[model samples]
Target: MHKQFSDVDTVRAELLQNLVDDGETVTNLGSITRLEVVSRIEEVTKKIISSLSMEEAPVLTLKSRSRWSNVRFSKLVGLLLTMGGTVSTLRSDCPSTVMKFALILKALSAIYKLVQSDSYVTKRDIYYNDPQLFGSQKTLDTIVDDISCLLKVPRRSLHVCASTKGLISGDLCYLEEDGTRVDCTSTVVPVSSSVSGIINIVSSAKFVLVIEKDATFQRLVDDEFCINFYPCIIITGKGVPDVNSRLMVKKLWETLHIPVFALMDADPHGIEIMCIYKYGSISMAFEAPTLTVSSMLWLGLLPSDIESLGLPQDALIPLTVADERKLNNIKKRPYMSFHPAWEKEMELMLRWKQKAEIESLVSIAPHFLTRVYLHNKLSYGGWI
Candidate 1:
């Protein structure tokens, strides 16, 4: 008989020892087979290697040659795709990461040598362009897999925590949220500031003027006038203001019984911004249930002021079918349900497609603004 140490017992001992070393508690030492023991050891070793490699992951720094070539290839592909899908032909013109294997195969062929025999080149030339062979594909695959997994999940799920304050983390600082690492510390600070500012103002003011543009807000401050002639706060910056700003403004108005007057440009984007502010449907900004400020009002860009301001004929951007239908439906509702001024303004915008900017009226004659507009709009006691 061949000398056979008990295979099953030996394997079970080995697997139990490996599991114990890997911080796993083996409940039954006798339960494992030799094959299972070997497999478990391999798996544990692979996990250790993966963790070490991740900790030692090399930073990808773009050199001048790499940057230029990458940009050139990207531009070529972008242009080709833009011009009716000519990317197949353009792929032949450059070696891009997207087609690295194909390019390497082509470069190795006799055809490639025949095309460039006289040219003097160094191994560095090929190495710089094809660094992946020298680098690690495993690392790249891990990163890509992580990104793919992240993209499949809902953005709100990425937040560290959700509270009445705002999204704690996992918000896309620039675009829509992905699993891309963001400094939660940096994002939360500004949100806190915005919340604090809103709380401060809402506690004091009888009404808040949420001005979309800084320039228009400056003009209002200079002239000492706003829609409701009440103390106001301006949301200055690009796109829609952040979630914290909207929440702060909304809570202040709702809790303090202070009304919010949204004054924005008369363009489609501007109107959409006001609607988002009033009704809270901007999913990208915040995930909370829709919060409509019952006291909120739209109070600028009246139809009667358009012709007098000499605005461009093209200033009248067309309303969408949805907007037209909304305005029409609002008109049929009882007067007590909606503000008469708001209903009238929406109807005028739907019919004429005309919009007037607050800037246009700002440049009007001082006499007209002070005597005719301001005096009529604001009472002697300075109430709107």
Candidate 2:
């Protein structure tokens, strides 16, 4: 638990205090339930309410780089990943700032209501709560994520719950905020806000396995992978992971002290998702210290394994134009050049111009993935 800010309560209270100190009334904030903004509200007052004086910029950092192969991996907890950044609203004339400045104040105001009511609102709720100002759900989401990064608090603590998008199962059980005891052993569990409150995780599992796709996750479940081979927890984000999924995995690793392995498609998007698990995403880089699982290793579906393992050639899909575009973007990323293994895989993919899905393992046999591929990969120590 690398908490950058004070506890959740303290942060929520401070947000409310800022609103009251700036003389913003409930009516001035507008209709939170109907997503309407009343006219004649002071935008200048909103900006003033949003900007806060800071003793220092955020003391968090991530694995970022400037040039090829120049990653600053040194764990400087108080330092930022990129060279320079805008922390406050005092400087910077970018047009983006004007909108973001207002959104931050709106978000803070929304959170204040949540704190006062002692309630939780989903991202969708907040989006619908103020569509006039938010414009789109994505805009609201980006602002909320930026707020979480800036405030140094988990989004859940800010009373924002992203629509849960991952599943979990295994020799594990936990309690939610409202005293709901969940037993994950016998069912596929949708991850709740396990990170926000007291999570009394009960598990005797050896390790946790995080799969990238829902199809592969279902395949493993159909094969009873966790029950037959090992006493372990299994999870999937279904695609690009959500915050709840990442947070659940981090909490499991920290609390259970078990090795966590990620299985993903042998493609740029897949690798990027896993990297977000191992290292925080560039957008949310500031929260890396609290969210990332640095020791999490890649399990399989590597590019070289496509040919080396002798899987059916028909199972491989040639890289599409869109896939190539994504690969090129990932290659240009500063952090990509630092890891030799990742760089090697990226090069191999570029050279071969092909990718494989975890489902490809099923070509060997229906249950080949869980029974053979993974078992052999683990037994032979074939993971990074």
lDDT of 1 by residue, 94-200 (tens): 44533432432333332123223423233334444446653543333322222212122211121111123223211112211223233321222123322322222
> 62-132 in candidate 2: lDDT tens per residue?
12222323222322111123333333442223564556656766886777667556577898998897799
State each model's CA lDDT, in order.
0.39, 0.69
Segments of candidate 2 deviating more than 4 angstroms: 1-83, 86-100, 328-338
| Model 1 lDDT-worst window of ten | 73-82
List TM-score per model, in order: 0.40, 0.76
Error of 2 at 248 (Å): 0.3
- Assess candidate 2 and give its TM-score to the true structure: 0.76
- State residue 365's C-alpha deviation in candidate 1, in Å: 2.1
